[model samples]
Target: MSDSDLIKLYSKQILALATEIPHLGTLEDAEGEAKARSPLCGSTVTVGLALADGKVSRFAQNVKACALGQASAAVLGKVVIGLDRTTLQQGRDALHAMLTKNGPVPSAPFDGYEVLLPARDFKNRHASILLPFDATLNAIDAS
Candidate 1:
């Protein structure tokens, strides 16, 4: 990619989000845990969580990835509290579509994901960007 393309993909907002990723550690009593990796970029994310009332009661993650992935994780961490699997799944799917199919931004709560729109053209970054969501979904199932 060109320097301008890289600049567009890794905007100040995305880089700032990367530095502010929340829930940075694992839960000691986590009921579920899962990890996802992007073979192309070697980016990885591990998620640990607990569910209560069919909603995410606790969430944490270890993200070792590109700025895009870290930004994605930060967005998820910002709104993961109190959300159910269905909503999380919808957000994940919507995010995937937005990146791959030019679909609309994910609805409320997940609207923070709109910052990632510039990444749509970088198909190689898509998997790493989705790692946090994939790991979280798997962790939920493991719970």
Candidate 2:
């Protein structure tokens, strides 16, 4: 697709993803939790995680952000629900690679993350897209 077409398509996908935001659980009985805020944009995310046998048993989030941040949280909510710690870390690494290193397009299961590919072109939005995952990783590390 042309650059403009790609941008339009990603914008539509981002908006569609945003609609899933309301489905994200805002609370969890987690072993640990972490909150992150972007003072530049006032976007904030709180990640709550439960651990069982050294694995992630539950994960949820509370987020107050713009469309980009909300959509990223929604995407995270879906894929992160059942992941183990290693996989979760891998996902975070994959996302970082996609966002910062022009890595390969995320494969199936995580193909939904492809919708965020456009975010790379817009640097200011990077933090918004990464915020939820960052908080989740922080929480997981602390757990």
Candidate 3:
């Protein structure tokens, strides 16, 4: 495969998501907050959330990473609202499998993770791709 093919991993769709981050701010009154960094690439993601009725009521993030990390943040932002810990954990597990174990895409709500399939072949990108979900879980645990 050519270098162009490797570069193509960041498709237009993924770039769109990356550049147009959805929940792209901080929640001052967040109940929990956590940040994750990829030591290999120096990519970072900080997530904050407030829970209501045991589900996500508000969510926000600051992402400093590549297009793949930004896209993952966008996908997480889109579906995080109203989600519970169980649902989030399932998504995280599925995402891990998809990237490392050749498993299917994450289930609904997180099914959008399919947009990241091309990234699976690039192991170096895996930690950045997983940052949003990991930060979210860390925040949840901290709360």
Candidate 4:
């Protein structure tokens, strides 16, 4: 597909996943949490997660970002539920690979992350797209 076509398609898919915005920018009933902000755009995302048996039992976020950031958070919210630690880590890895190098497409489950491929070209927006996942990983490590 053309670049514009890719961007338009992914943007719509990403936006469709974001069903609700957290009022306080935080998760509910979370056992682990972290927050991140982008200095470039003043966008912020806070992720909350609950872990049980080394799997995520709950995942949610409160985000205040541009369309890119909001869409990223929405996509994350949709896909991250029910993921194990290993799967979550893989998702993070896939996201980093997609952002830094032209690598293999993300595998199933996280394959939805490919929607973010078009975002790589917009370097300044990288942090916005990554903010939710970054905070989530931080929360995992902090737990």
Query: Using TM-score as the measure, which candidate wins?
Result: 1
TM-score, structure 3 vs. true: 0.95
Which of the predicted structures, 1 or 4, would earn the higher lDDT when compared with the native? 1
Residue 138 miss distance in model 2 (angstroms)? 1.1
Model 2, position 18: C-alpha lDDT score? 82
Ten consecutive residues with minimal summed lDDT in candidate 2? Answer: 21-30
Better of 2 and 4 by TM-score: 2
Candidate 4, residues 1-113, lDDT tens digits: the string is 58786566457666765544433355667789888999999999987888888777777778888777887776677677677767767877887788778766678776766
- In model 4, pairs of residues that clash are 25-62
Q: What are the Cα lDDT values of the candidates?
A: 0.96, 0.78, 0.92, 0.74
TM-score of each: 0.98, 0.83, 0.95, 0.79
Best-fitting candidate, measured by lDDT?
1
RMSD of each: 0.6, 3.2, 1.2, 3.7
Whole-model alpha-carbon lDDT for candidate 1: 0.96
Q: Tens digit of lDDT per residue, candidate 2, span 1-143?
A: 48895566468779888888733565546788899887678899998888777766677788888888988888878777656677767777787789899986566546678888877766677787788878888888878
What tens digits encode model 1's per-residue C-alpha lDDT throughout 32-142?
999999999999999999999989999999999999999999999999989999999999999999999999999998999999999999999999999999999999999
Total clashing pairs in model 4: 1
Q: Which ranges in model 3 have alpha carbons more than 4 Å from their true place?
A: none
